[model samples]
Target: MTAARAAALPGSEAPAGDERLGEILRALDEDFLAVLGWDWERRVITWPRQHPVIGLPDCPVPGCPLAITVSTRPMCGGCMERWRGSSLPLEEFLLVPKQTSRGTGQGPCVVAGCGRPRVTVAGRLCLAHHVQHTSAGLRVLSLEEFLAHPGVVGHAEFGPCEVAACYLKAVSGQVPYCEAHLNRLYRARTAPGFDEAHWRRTDKAICTTREVSLRGMPERLVAELLYGLWVRTREGFKSRPECLRPVYDRLRARQVQQLEEVTDPAAHGHGREQVTMIRAGSERCAC
Candidate 1:
């Protein structure tokens, strides 16, 4: 489900509903029944199909309803295994008459806003995003650009470290360097002619952890993120304190000064989450 939709849910934002105020009831499928009593009805409940957070698409081969195995390769796992040895060009392979059987299940695509399942566990992509990765030389930098949001930074936004080329996320509100940089600073504080400015330019970035530095990021983007965070914490459901590095990286590359400017569903995952938080907080403030 979209972040906005998830945040808007009665239980998603806050676990409050009329069902909790009435008599207790039970269903055969006890899963989430108590939580969803307010919205429940007598019916079969097939998950994912009824409400899949993201979906997988069918293979490109005509008359094949089976899903493709790889997003970039544009074929089912069975087909992909066969194509590797056939050595037939992709176009020819697609045109050639072939049959496909039901393949194995796949996980959701990694591209944040994409709604398709990945072809394989290793590639972690949907068909459309895979095409972009292959044709456009896609260098996805945003931590949130994919479904796996890298949770390395701290809850508070401390901006980037001051060390040169050391693009580690600053963990402390007072200190300007990341934990690694701070330790390095402690070791070299008294070295000859070693000042903060000189160190920033002289040192190379040492990315040992899953952290991302916002040192060179534009101020406008940072401001947007800060404002969004402020709104998110008001009440109801709030996002994880740790922001995605790829999310900021993607926004920076796009030169998006504001989150509202983004529209593409696949690229709008972060923005969608922000919208839900803002909307929920607004509702709380009005009450």
Candidate 2:
């Protein structure tokens, strides 16, 4: 190695060749420049750099002013990223589209003295006004009037608590769960083997206990039968009354007997197979 290059090397030990000396020199130069505060190139390579922000995009989150980009969510980067890997569906990022009027979209809101543009082709009112009117049982109100109202346009009194089999109104707390279930959930939050998926699945089954399927039979009696069957089941037992217990028991037996006859595997396998196909066809038909 040359004298200057040799001096740059540690101790008096010399690099065996020019190639080794060149490598050491380049490494030392990089270190020297990094100490002198010219390390941006290295930093850029090591860490990702955000692209320059372009036009303004409002966050979909209420009361948040963050500009949106990168993710598909209308919310800002922070809110959108917070929901990453969450149970909430991505489709919920787009709230319901506002109704708007047709044509060039140049006119002011249909409500007098309102200046906001229409959001739908069918409605003349701005989205806010339209929602207020529709949600308030079609009562017309000016922007100021709607704002001055004591209650939220869509809020109803004594709405059912989120928990199943809990008849109490929802507590006006940060959590949507009823007072009892809120405590239950809070206590379970740190419990071992507590699964949110299991809780949700159970809750869904409970909430749909009363929902009747209207397909095929096209009669109110069919709805009654379905409701009766659900009420007699273990999941719906909490809501069933003692007076109707015998009635439900008889109904359940009759229903099971009828279902068996309709669905039974016959002496010939073809009979059961034909019944299965018929059942599938009936389920698929809109009627």
Candidate 3:
């Protein structure tokens, strides 16, 4: 059948919810159907829908979610994949928020309360305050823009070495360090070393060990064992000494309790035989 006739036939209509139909129409007008060897109206309408738009339309860079126009040549996955190695103008596609003025119609300052032009991540202060303030509030810089700044130096916040540290900064979009350092400090001070297998084993042993003398076995020893084991594990190895302090304190308290019972015969005597039997069994079983 003729292209126009084919295009008008039943089922030769655009699918529902296809917003790009206008673009498709433009393509058809430009002989796209002729190039694909299909009747313009029929083929265009009859083409089976295969792919759906995937992922958010905004920039995938962490902390950035501005809806960038597809036609404005926004940075896509391919661009981001090679972003570090190349110096392409990816920032050109970045969507900058519009600056709002005060009721007086004057741009007082980008930052609240401060009457200064916002500083770039590179520590570039406005000409008026450039020499006056060396250390100002933290500047919000893009990954590329931050790299381009002369004074903007990257600091490592986690991992075994410097490279791992830099990788964290690159991924987190934070200024000085990544979130891992903060998490490590917080965990160290607040959370106990819960992942050490040896710690758990020793804890179990301490709970079950029954010899009256052994019953009063130092809690410090158990704690030390836990801390040591934690250090040996991957999580422990990464943990700072401060993070291990709580574990140390817990074990120390246990040691103190054992010592107290040992010194006071009355506290530990009644359970002595039972404790002994339990300890004997534990030793035999290698628990």
The numbered model that scores best in TM-score is: 1
For all candidates, what are the clash counts? 11, 7, 6
Clashing pairs in 3: 7-41, 7-42, 188-243, 210-275, 219-254, 219-255
**TM-score for all predictions?**
0.24, 0.20, 0.18
Tens-digit lDDT track of model 1 for 87-152: 899888877755544432234556555444444434566545555555533345342543343422
**What is the alpha-carbon lDDT for the whole of candidate 1?**
0.43
Please list the residue runs of candidate 3 whose C-alpha ends up more than 4 Å from where it truly belongs after superposition.
Answer: 1-51, 59-166, 170-177, 187-189, 194-287
- Which stretches of model 1 miss by more than 4 angstroms? 1-166, 169-213, 241-243, 268-271, 275-287
Worst 10 residues of 1 by lDDT: 42-51
> Model-by-model lDDT, in order?
0.43, 0.37, 0.29
Best candidate according to lDDT: 1
1-287: candidate 2 lDDT, tens digit per residue: 23464355344333355442243233333332222222221110110112221123455655443445433455655566555755667666445232221221122345555544444334455555666667845477665665556553333223444543233344433555444455667776687888754442233111111111121221222223332222223122222122222222322323332222453433234334333433343332222
Lowest lDDT 10-residue stretch of candidate 2 = 40-49
Model 2 lDDT, residue 42, Cα: 15
Using TM-score as the measure, name the better of candidate 1 and candidate 2: 1
